[model samples]
Target: MALWSGRFEQGVSEGAQRFGASLPVDRAMYAQDIAGSIAHARMLGRQGILDAADVERIEKGLLNIKRQMDEGTFVWDLNDEDIHMAVESQLIRDVGAAGARLHTGRSRNDQVATDTRLYAKELLLSLVDGNDALRKVILTSARTNFGVIMPGYTHLQHAQPVLFSHHLLAYFWMLTRDHVRLVAAWRSADANPLGSAALAGTTYPLDRAYTTELLGFSHPIPNSMDAVSDRDYLLDLLYACSVSMMHLSRLCEEIITWSTTEFGFITLSDAYSTGSSIMPQKKNPDFAELTRGKTGRVYGDLMGLLTTLKSLPLAYDKDLQECKEGAIDAAGTLQDAMACVGGMVATWQVNADAMRAQASRGFTAATDVADYLARRGLPFRDAHEVVGELVLYCERRRKGLEDLTLKELRSFSPLFDDDVLEGLDPEGIARARTTYGGTGHEAVKTQLREAARQLGRDRRQASSLRGRMPNVTGD
Candidate 1:
């Protein structure tokens, strides 16, 4: 029977008990739950609400349970509605009345909130590490292939010549913004709510600050009602996971497209690919495709939780039980997706020759040719018109802009001198855009250095945050 069954005329039906249980889902947070209970027990002893002897016994028993959990020998009770009931009931059986005192000043409302916040800190840091590891792989890939040239696209059409390093740096910046979101989620979950005791503050003179110190929370939450009901931190975490997965999916889509026979820009490693059962000559990027497909699932996790928490009443409710599973799923999904993509990109071979060959075929130098005319005294609009006509002329005769002789170029505009050919080639065109954030070789190198600096800083921040997370130690 439940601890609250004392006043009930009859116990709940077995089906209702099974239906309302959150233990199976929340038991994943056993360590957090145990740690929160121990801290609460110590606070009770300090406040003179319980005998030190009782507190000592509670601590020892909880530690033993934790040890059992660590060793994979903890027996789970299917009849218990949640982990709190299971632990409290077993503690009473083992330590008698002293164990029953563990719940004297607190409610399950504040207890579960504490557990979820601690676990969120852990999940957020893990994703930071995941984000960092993948960023490192991307940065290294950029530095190693700094000299490769590719066509930059707009509307899926080649619009400019760009260094390959610049192209990959775009994803690096996307992940950098993800770190910002993670920091927000971490802050939101860093508060202590264990002393709220249901919807109203308890009358036990509980020192919430002491418990906050013991549990390593940033501060005690100010409002009891919000403390029990607030799940914005979990929402923030799910949002981070969703956005990061979207970024990874975008990268995976490109990997899928680039590995195709028509693009041939990359060759995925055999370990990251698979052979078709029916097609004798197929090497498919199945992992990348799966990463792309799994993005929608993470999106669903975020949206599901958003709807679950929509305008629910003040204080905790059964609807809150629906929150944990989706956040847990999204975190694990994103971590695995990062691992798979990091390995995929790290091992896949870059086909520089194919990339460079395709870069020159799309009239990619037309803008540069027009820029040449603009610099030679033609008005800017006239220069654009002149390049448009030149492109049509080349299309008719099946010749590239580079194929035009100085005499043929001067026929359209005497401003087209012999030196106009200097920047007309692939490498020259890519290297000519010397502006910051451009595709020039030097510009990309600048981006690489800044990316390296920011990656180091984010890793250090993640490490500092991880180190300060809650621990079972009395300190």
Candidate 2:
């Protein structure tokens, strides 16, 4: 029988029945729902709403249902609509009157909201850990290539020389910002909403603050109407996931480019790459490509939920049911993608010789040569013009700036001395950038130390949260 059939004169049509059901999607929340019910039952007993015997019966019946489900002995009915009704029906069958009393001051709206919050709180820590793992893989790669130089580009044209480590650490900082966004999302899901029945507050003299304390929530939700209706926490999480996926997509894009024969800066392991069916020499970075492609689907999940919530009224509506699937999809997609990227990076080979070879090509040290001239009393604009002429001379002669003799270089600008040859070296170009965040070797070491510290902090925080989260009562 339907849980809400008392008000209907006839059964719902098959199409309406199937359309209204959320059992297939929401069945994943069964454990959280059961945990919440157990907490609520104990609270009800303490509030004198039920006797000790009744509380024991309700708890036993709930646990029994959980056990049956775990053992695969329970049948989930499609017509049950959602996890809440399905569990409650079994509770009633097991414990009779006391099982029916379990719903004395609760509604599925508040119940599901509480369950989602608990679930979100747990997942936020997981996503943070995943972010940390990916960051560590990047930092390790950076540390391994500290002295290797690369041609830094502006508008896809060679602009200057830079340490490869500095280039990799840029993505590390991007993931750190992504971690901060996820922390905010975690806090958003930390409020307790279980006492806000249906739409308005319940009338059973229930202590919402007491439940919040038991559940380890930061606080009870301040407004009852907002408690059951709010899905902003889910939106915050999906937004974080979407943005993190985008960051990963950018990194994946670089990996794909770097692994190609044209760049040849790195080579992905055979496990992470695939070969073309007809071409024996083709080793494709398919994993990285797929991660780039998954970014769009995660973005779609964000937009889909935003559209669903836009047209709804202030209070709870059926439209809210559309929110759950997107959150689950976004979280799962990011989690898997992060794991795949981390594994790929941990074992991939870095071609340091190839990276160094490409670093000095195309007059990449022209900026340092211009700086040398400027330091010798030439105005920067004049020094830039002088360097441009020297670059043009090198291009016309099919030679490099380093190939010019001191007399030849001095012919272009009398400010040039034998010391000018040092400025044209790629290694010297990278080492000369001694600014706090520049591409120098010392700067990268400082960055590595800081990145390691942050990774340790994230791992510790995730550990502490996991320990506390399991004991959180649904009340």
Candidate 3:
């Protein structure tokens, strides 16, 4: 029988019961459900709807249920539809009639809404923490590899030589935006929805603000119907997760490519890699590839929730039950992916020599050389054309620009001098980029300092949130 079965004359079939139950998906919200119930009970007592003794009895029963669930002693009967009903039914059995008073001013509509908000808030905070850890790893890697030059590419062909630190910092900024998205998602959930009973306001004199304060929400939701029906917090969270996963997948694609024998740019540590089953010599980057592959799963979760919410009308609906599994799946998949990537990055080895070797080939210095010719009184367009001829001559002779002698360069343009050789070297080309935010070593140092400042601010924000939750520590 269901918890609301008093109105029905017969029980639902066992198969129907199993098919309709949300216990498997909602069980993860048990802690949130208990926390919301406790706040609701205290609000009822404060408003004189429930006696102080009943409040104490309800709190005690909820805590005991939490303990049994924590200790693996609680029986999770399939007859219970979800974690909310399961715990409430247990509370009634334990505390007799006072347990019934726990729901005096609320309905499961707003109650489950409140619980989901709490769950989303906590998950958002966890995601912020993960983003911080990843930011730190990227900033550290960038700082350590600041001077290591790599071929900056367009269309997978060398376009210029860029400092490796600059490349790494680009990803750091992408993740910083992810941290911002998590903050927005967290705020979306920072409101109490407890007093919106079913689709309308409750008749009892419940203080929604008091419950909001007890639950650490910013305020009580203003509209009764909107409060019960809103799953925007979940939508915001899933969207954030989806975008973050996309960014991570892009980084993972780079990792997979950079680690391959073809690129020879990085090596994964054993802790973050797996060996082939039959190959005698193989160290496969399974973790990075998995992060890349799981990105579509997060995308699917986002689309599934959007489809579920698109046509639904008004206040709570059974269709809303379809929302939980996708949000939970997206969050879980993203968290695991972030962890795997963070660990892989923290332990992996950067192949500086290989990166530097690729930096010099494919005319990475052609741009600097053109600029040098243009500076020496050649019209910029004309300088480009003349350098193009020099490159063509070198290609015909199976020679690089660096391989050409001072006399050979003079054949293309009379501007060539013994000093021109100084501008042609890869190291000099990288250093010649003195513009702000260029690939020069000094510019990379400036970028690193700015990155550190941003990372410090994010850490302080995360730490302040940690101070709010004494029960949670170190992710």
- Write model 1 residue lDDT over 261-370, tens digit each, in one string: 99999999999999988999999999999999899999999999999999898878989988899989999999999999999989989999999998998799999988
As a whole number from 0 to 100, the lDDT of residue 152 in candidate 3 is 89
Winning model by lDDT: 1
Q: Write the per-residue lDDT of candidate 3 for residues 1-475, one digit (tens) a residue.
A: 5668899999988898888899999988888899889888888888888889999999889988988888889998878988889999999999999997787877899988988988888888888988989889888888777688788899989888888888888889899999988888888988888899998887888888888877878888999999998998898999999999999999999999999998999998999888987996999888888998898999998899899999889978999988889988988888888888888888889999999899888988787778888889998899889888888988898888889998888888898778776855666677777788887778878888988999899889877765553121111
Once superposed on the true structure, which residue ranges of model 3 sit more than 4 Å away at CA?
A: 467-475
Colliding pairs, model 3 = none
| C-alpha lDDT of candidate 2 relative to the true structure | 0.87
| Rank ordering of all candidates by lDDT, starting from the highest | 1, 2, 3
What are the runs in model 1 whose C-alpha is more than 4 Å off?
473-475
lDDT pick, better of 2 and 3: 2
Angstrom error at residue 356, model 1: 0.5
* Per-residue error (Å), model 3, residue 325: 1.4
Q: Estimate each model's TM-score.
A: 0.97, 0.96, 0.96
Which one wins by lDDT: 1 or 3?
A: 1
For residue 112, model 3's alpha carbon misses the true position, in angstroms, by 0.9
> What lDDT does the true structure give each of the candidates?
0.91, 0.87, 0.86
